[model samples]
Target chain A: MACDLSPVLLSVRVALISTVLNMIMGTILAWVTENKRFPGKNLLETVIGLPLVLPPTVIGFGLLLLFGKHGPLGYFLAEFLHIRVVFTWWAAVIAAAVVSLPLMYKSAKTGFASIDKNLEQAARTLGSSETRVFFTVTLPLAAPGVIAGLLLSFTRALGEFGATLMLAGNIPGQTQTIPLAIYFASEAGDTRTAVFLVIVISFISFLITYGLNWWVDGRSSMRKGG
Target chain B: MLEVTVKKVLTDFTLEVDFTISDGILVLFGPSGAGKTTVLQSIAGLSIPDYGLIKLNNRIFFSAAQVINVPARLRRVGYVFQEYALFPHMTVKQNAMYGIKGCKDMDGRYKLSVLDVMEMLKITHLQDRYPVSLSGGEKQRVALARALMTEPDLLLLDEPLAALDDKTRRQLRGELKELQRRWQIPFIIVTHDRTELNYLADAALFLRNGKPYRVLNRNKEQPYD
Candidate 1:
């Protein structure tokens, strides 16, 4: 039988979109949490980091309560915006973004914090406004961390299974990403397709991790040489 | 018309200083932990004085009484840090030009072109180089170039030449004096090196124990040492 490639395409699409979302939202959140002082800062930090330690199934359950038809956000979206997120590919994207955010946030924050504050003060003495200083001096210096976050988040989003199954549902050719497809194929005793999907995922995961290591090694050596 | 009277409690001893200089280089000569850096910080608006006032020309930088504190960004103060806090990622040219705020005639605002400043500091050839590859002297010049580009009314240096070798330090001493004369701006240098005081000080504050024991100016014909 010809292998169904729909899951592969769907996984890539979901992972790509979610990674972009996570990068934008996560980096901004990291910068804010790192630089600013405000009330509930610790609470906000805990919430952002909760996804990493929490079970994926538990996250899906929480997401379900928020996105169910009669739920608060779901009700407003359906009535006002005419958009429904539950049990759809959109839900898969949301799940991936939420789950992978902490990796991005933590990495970006560490990168920003490692910089000497004097560099920023140097910029300030040059008449650089706070916003300009961030973009010019701060953000460029933190770029390696941001790129690492993007790569990690993409891989995490790609392999998302438990939460995707619960929130998006494994609809064939639509929301059936690689992990869900592999599970269903194995459950049905379709060993051939299951093995093929497993190898594909394993290779992708290996490549991502290897690429991350190579990048980090090269960057550190480059810094040392400079 | 620069005037300052600052007092702030530190970890060990209270830093109480009151001095004024209209022009020329004024050196704060003291040992480590003597609050020399703190005094420069206060003048640059980087640190606020607990009580007293700082004024340059007529602009009030900080005042505990009036409760007025102008932040460092708007204070028009040039500060050269000890370690030359140049942006490692940016080239010498970029760092040099980083301070040039909007001026159609950049010559008129800062009273010198960016290229001229780099040339005067003799770092024009190293424009494309990063700070990491630069020698101690080159890095110092880049820092001075960056600060001078901003056209600050008063310039503050915190052990600016401390990291340099003796030869470079001696060479820069004369250059700094010439620079002050050409720029015609008041300078406050924080250094304990008596050699620096003898070579560069038009006025000097000798601090022994967090208190300025003597304030000597050239017009008074008193020896700095």
Candidate 2:
């Protein structure tokens, strides 16, 4: 009875899905925010990073206001489209994406900013289109930073707790990500399962941190030595 | 043939310059901060001057009144920077072949393959090497090869030999002059060094504070030659 396999597997599945989806959105948004500075760019950056500092419950409340059953868009979706966002896997994804967005954007933006603008100018002179230059020179050069951002965002999404719990309500198999499972187990007086989840989360966090450091340091040394 | 006349007023200096080149090396000579390199940049379409005209081989590259400003890619110009600015990530071969897009030979094949120029510059063995791995002279050679491989109508070098030591600079200068003689294209060499102006220049134009002050005829009045 203590070793329930169902919820653990469900937690991993939800975490993985949320991480990958958030990473994709983070990469796209990061590239746009860093590469192109238009009117109200600062405002966009602030909005993207808002969830990082805002209370997790506040974020969940905000999402609920926008996507809950009685919420404006949520009611329309349920009535017209029959889509449920609250207490669902999709809500967990939205929560994770919101919280992890800043990590991705900051990492990618720094990476793109560090690249030499002259390289792009040279490519333009060589008859490369704007799109080609971005793909070939700019993206490759900024790749390390992008990878770093991805790892950071992935780790953040995996550990998402407050917003996930508030918005998705700790559904046993549907919305129970790793962090939520741990919280729910501890609340249910199942210290053994809670401790088990904690250890796993700790190990994952250690591995991701180590991987990011190793990658970034190795690149720096290679560049310096060369 | 390349003809250029442009003017730009910067905070510290005003750049008003004019020159022409045809099938020979033309040197822009002046002291530092003379805006000689600005003239070359303007020709390459890297920097636009306030008011002027730039025509390469009878094609107007930039004209203020006509509102014509051709981008750098369409200019078909090969610019060798003072720092070389070779792509650090690419090998010598990749750098050389960078500008050889849509090239065709007499047989309608891609003409000016990087291998030929690699051999011509004696850089065949160094093709696999990166810019960071090469010495100053070797980098200069690779940069020169890269620029010439483009088969441009005109070549612009901004103190191409300025970064090397005296011995290497002289050696490269001799090689560059000889290379110019072998190629059938207009060349513009910008440098503040009188020694380089004397050695490589077919004709020299002196710049002062972003303006052309003197046009020295190499055949008649070159002090060093």
Candidate 3:
């Protein structure tokens, strides 16, 4: 029997959306925190990074409280905006994004920090505006770290399970990602389907890791050659 | 003409500088940690001073009392860093053209053209190369070309030849002096090399402990050391 491919498709879509969101939010947050000083900066960074250490179920519970039907946000969103987010595909995306944000943030922060600040000052003296300097110099220099962060977030989102299971539920054809589908397949004595999904996930993970290694190695070699 | 009277207090020391530059090269001669770079930075609008004023060509670049601090991009000053600080990701051509595209003068025209600056610096052939691929002298020339693309009223070079070998430094010193004479803009150079002072400086300012110790005019044959 041909195995269903819907779960794989849904997983890829959710991961892609979540990774893009993480990329934007992570890069901005990293840049701001790296370059600016403000009161309570450390606290803010710690709070954003909490998800990395917290249990996924705990995060899911928090999200559940915020987005559940009787919850304040859920009630306001449903009654006023006539929109529901719980147990939906968007909920999976949000869950994955929240869980994977810290990884991107940390990597991008390091990237920005490693750049020589004198370069930016030189640009300023050359009559480039702050915005132009950032786009022309800062961002390009930090591209490798940002790209690495993006790939890590993408893979993390693809493998997300616990929070997604809690917030989005295991609704077939809607929110049943590969991880959840594999779980259900194993529990239902469908060993073949579970094995297939495990292989697919492993293969994807290998490709991502290999790609990251290749890119990093190529960059280092170019630097050495130059 | 540029006039600067600024005071900045750092954790280890306080920088109190008062100087004036009309035209030709003015060298800031001092040992390391004498706050030479700080003075240059303040003039370039990169370092904010706690008090006093910086006037360039009669325009108030910074005035603490009046709160008239123009942003760095509008200051129209070229600063070439000691490290040459070229954007490693950009080609020499892109780096040279960076300042020309974004800045505009009062009448709404670019200050200088990339082609003109690159040709003037003789770095037109290296425009397609990246900074990492260029030799130290080539990098320095590209940096100067990039800075000149803005058509600055004043040029500030912080230890411009410090990173090159002795032979390269000797050759470039003469080239730099010739360029300054041709440009006719006030050039402020920070260096500890006494020979460099004799070779290029029309005047030299001796700085010690973050303060101006003395000002010497090369024409007067004042002892620099």
Candidate 4:
């Protein structure tokens, strides 16, 4: 019998949406924290990095409280906006975004830090405005790091399973993702489907990792770009 | 004409300097830590003085009492840093044309001409090449081209030829003198090289340990203003 493909589609949708969120929110956080000096900077950095080390169940528990119909944001969202997020696809997206943000932030920060400061000063002396300099000089130089960040972020979001399972639940066509499908397929003795999904996910992971390695190797650090 | 009477306090010592220079090459001759670069930075509006006045051609660049400090971009001055400071990502042509595109023509005295500056500095052929691909002398010329393209009223060159070989250094010294004569702007060069002092300086002010020690003139009579 042909296996169900709904899990694959739902996984792709969640990963794509989460990756977009990671790009915008992660890069903005990196730029702000890297450039400015404000109070509680250390605290902010710790909070950003907390998801990297936190247990997925713990994160799910926190999300449950926050969006469980009567919780603060959940109450406001449900009452004012008529949206419920406790066990939905949007909750899966939020979980993936929160988990993958630190990687993107770290990568972008490294990219921005590797830039030679004198180049910025040179542009300034040449009469370019700060915004102009950022677009024309800063962003281009930091492209490699930013690209690396995006790739890593996308991969991390794709592999997200724990928080997603707890928050979105295995709702078949509505919220069943690849990892959840594989687990239930084997548990229910559906060996053929389980084997197929395992192979597919492993193959995709190998492709992403190999591509990332090759891309980074082609542009090693301190090698002058002409 | 430019007049500067500025005092800046550094960690090791205090910097108190006073001078008045006109349209000629004025060399700030000093040792390593004598705050020579600070003076150049102050004149270029990159550094703030503790207290004093920097007046150039009736425009107040900075004044402590009058509460004025013009930013670097609006100062109508060009600064060529010691390391040449060219945008590594940009080609020679882009670097040379950087300051003149968006900004208005500076004060209507010196025309904005990238072609003239590039042709005069002998960097016209290097328009498409990046900074890393260029040799030391080529980089220096590109830096000069970038600075001069703005047609600034004051050009600050910090150790312009210090990184070149002896032959290239000698060659650029002569070209710099020619460029200075043609530009006719106040060229304040910071250098410790005695040869540069004799060759390019129409006037020289020696600095020691963050203070203006003395002033030597080739044409003017008095030392201090």
The DockQ-derived docking category for candidate 4 is medium
Clashing pairs in 1: none
Every candidate's DockQ is 0.57, 0.38, 0.81, 0.57
* Candidate 2, A1-226: lDDT as tens digits: 4565555566556666766776677767777877787999889889988988999889988998989888998999999999998988888888887888788778878878888876766665665566777877788878887888878887887788888888888777677777877877898999998888888888988998998898879888998998
Candidate number with greatest lDDT: 3
Taking chain A of model 2 alone, its TM-score versus the true chain A equals 0.91
* TM-score of every prediction relative to native: 0.91, 0.88, 0.96, 0.90
User: How far out, in Å, is residue B100 in model 3?
Assistant: 0.6
Q: Could you tell me which 10 consecutive residues in candidate 3 chain B have the lowest summed lDDT?
A: B216-225
> Where is model 3 more than 4 Å wrong at Cα?
B106-113, B219-225
Candidate achieving higher TM-score, 1 or 4: 1
Instruction: Name the lDDT value of residue B35 in candidate 2.
Output: 86
Off by over 4 Å in 2: A1-37, A68-82, B102-110, B219-225
Candidate 2: which docking quality band? acceptable
Model 3 lDDT per residue over B1-225, tens place: 899998999767898888888999999999989999998898898989999999998999999999988988888899999999999988999888888766667576555667787888889899899898998999999999988877789999999999899999998998999999999999999999999988988988888888877788865755432
> Lowest-scoring 10 consecutive residues by lDDT in candidate 4 chain B?
B101-110
**For model 2 chain B, the run of ten residues with the poorest summed lDDT:** B101-110
Q: Which candidate has the top score in DockQ?
A: 3
For candidate 1, lDDT tens digit of each residue in B64-174? 989999877888889999898999999999988888752122443326688999999999899999998999999999999999987888899999889999999999999
Candidate 1 chain A: worst-modelled 10 consecutive residues by lDDT: A1-10
Clashes per candidate (backbone, < 3 Å)? 0, 0, 0, 0
